[model samples]
Target: MSRSGVAMSRRTRLDSELVRRGLARSREQAVAAITAGRVLVGGIPATKAATVVDGSTSIAVTKGDDPGYASRGAHKLLGAFEAFGVPAPGPEPGPGAEIPRSTGPTLVVAGRRCLDVGASTGGFTDVLLRYGAGTVVAVDVGYGQLLWRLRCDPRVRVLDRTNARNLTPAEIGDRVDLVVGDLSFISLALVLPALRACAVPDADFVLLVKPQFEVGRERLGPGGVVRDTALHAEAVHDVAASAAMLDLGVRGVTASPLPGPAGNVEYLLWLAAGAPPLDADVLAGAIAAGPAGPGRRA
Candidate 1:
């Protein structure tokens, strides 16, 4: 059903499709997640779980919108840790490699104070807690959105109706050791300054980068997806450059094991205070690897 007069394929409900694809374990879980706005179709947020979609339409679960793991996004962070070798979780990429995997010392969080931005449903917070973080300050722009379980947990300090752009060390009581963020809608450029302000002089960070939100609207294509590889590269480059300006050293950039809702390819940009930004060649190499498909395993 297009101007070309091509026949349209059959459509299915978002929740049912999730179960059909094994993206969700059960219909009830799918419905709960979808109703919570955790599902996206064709790069746009689906308003209803029952919305119909055709084969050409790509549907994906929003990161951190899972019924389990505090948020579906917890898996994404765990993958980042393993891939980035945060606390050295997996194999280290060889020299001259575009991205390094599994190479950091086991920097466990037994005594680390943490900050979770875009702490929607406390997905990242959950990960920190599971790793034995000392304290977790969860910040989000919405109210009553965090699951009651985490909202009431002693280890989690919920700061609802708060914006990362306005965050302060005073608000958090102290600078943090670990800062993990999974934000949406806003560009990283806008939030990095606030993060810089709230982080300890040497805080380590792992931030989720959604290209659709970072790339200018002009760079986006139909359905708000940024399909052009060059545009994708530029999106990440711009974010890295912004961090450089703030003196946050680049650790590495890797394709997320999970894509953004609506199937937009996303990345995890790791940084730390006082470390050097990655050389241009290394940056370019990572870009050449591209973010178009299921990328190399970290």
Candidate 2:
């Protein structure tokens, strides 16, 4: 404040001021420095790292470090976006669309009886509803873990403690137009059969591919991670091949924008019932890029 020869403005927490001023490298770094007792404010040491500060505050960092994602698996999805050319999710321009133009355009799940095989916390289900799906039958083995926001939504019908393999057309009482899955502890091969049973000709399929599950237990690295790129490729191919055999056309393959827990990379395979098979090489290349990663317009 003295530098400006004006009354030193009310002081502020150094880290907050830095972030507010776009001076600090990152919020994580600011917090880390404050936690490490390396940040000073107004020529005095600050105690709590998250303390608030003002524009006049002076700060210094004692070290350098890398900031991390909400989850480490974010990097895998980031890799997918880099490889694929799918548009990143962003704010859509203008008004009048039933679906808000922003927050990523909804994939056509609306008015179509749909199923989310592994609807944990309902991320996909959330996306499905945003797209104006008539109803989403969200099935998961776990109980009461869906996001509260989705559970309260009228469009969703939660089916906890249900196994996808056990689902039948009779239970739904109607055929499904789209069946999206994100299962764990089971291979897509096992789940595909049940989905086939539920779909009519011309139905759409979107399932997640986790190399950790598709590959043999032996190939999994420490902590149940699958780090091999080649194995990742094989897992995608195996799922697509199985779908092809079921007479489900492999429409497209993309990476999820969000990574799975335990940092395992995941994939999204789009399929259509009764559609012709896709060329293997083309399909593989599309997945190698961000199938569901960046470039997705919101």
Candidate 3:
């Protein structure tokens, strides 16, 4: 309790608290508002990257409207679905499964189970459900970061404070047809095996590749953002190589529709188990050309 007669305790990360309480749609949006000098900590402007503050501090945002989903990550995946022709999963016939259907021959998630790695604020989970996924096991290392809207969603299974790198198939209880990851800070190589364990043969994967994390520490600029075009290409190559090592085929790579925190450029890659992956030249060409824009409609 403060002298102002406010109960302030249980310090929490500003970004996560914003999502959990429905003040923001996603942690990315909260970070955006905070970085833009829009977020208030105890009625004062805050700009730190990750600040722990009392939940009762009367946090407010100068921004007028909140995001459409819990996190900006949703828009990134939405871009892939639009660019690559991935469609919504089909209706659930009965109790437990959902199948996906595409307008063309593109693979769908109509009746597939999914795992959302780094499911903070449940933005990806939210997208998965909206596309009619029967069930999405949303996992994040941080606790209580999932938005109430996502938490209340019957199709999403919230797994807070759980690291995807440590996950096992037994923990998930069934093989999944799709796996999507938007992980940060760690190398994808370390977590790919864990995610692979959860996927059934022929399952597809969509991963957000953050060059800042994939490149060597020396390549990163201030605030941990990657900016060099060469570095971006190298990072993508590293991820492609790693996927190949796992016997996962990289079908395609596309730039994210949205820039990451601090305006870092990012890429999204689609991989399928047992299918032939994209060649190095193809991956490099995609990077050079940039994400297939809205002009390349799905």
> What overall lDDT, based on C-alpha atoms, would model 3 receive against the true structure?
0.74
Off by over 4 Å in 3: 1-67, 88-105, 291-298
- Among all candidates shown, the one with the greatest TM-score: 3
Tens digit of per-residue lDDT, candidate 3, span 156-198: 7878888999998887778788899999989888888888888
- What digit string (tens of lDDT, one per residue) describes model 2 on residues 68-110? 3222332332232222222233345357634423332223554
When summed lDDT is taken over every stretch of 10 residues in candidate 3, the lowest stretch is: 289-298
Q: After best superposition, candidate 3 residue 132: deviation in angstroms?
A: 1.2
Over 1-298, each residue of candidate 1 has an lDDT whose tens digit, in order, gives: 8789998677776666788888788655665565445777877555444456666779888777344567778766765664554442223456885652334433346569999999998878887786678999999999888888888889889899999999999999989998899999899999999998898888888888888999887878888887776776778778888998888877767666556778777777788766666556655565565432122221
Between candidates 2 and 3, the one scoring higher on TM-score is 3
Over the full model, what C-alpha lDDT does candidate 2 score relative to the true structure?
Answer: 0.64
All models: lDDT? 0.73, 0.64, 0.74
RMSD of each: 11.4, 12.4, 14.5
Off by over 4 Å in 1: 1-67, 87-108, 284-298
Q: Order candidates by lDDT, high to low.
A: 3, 1, 2
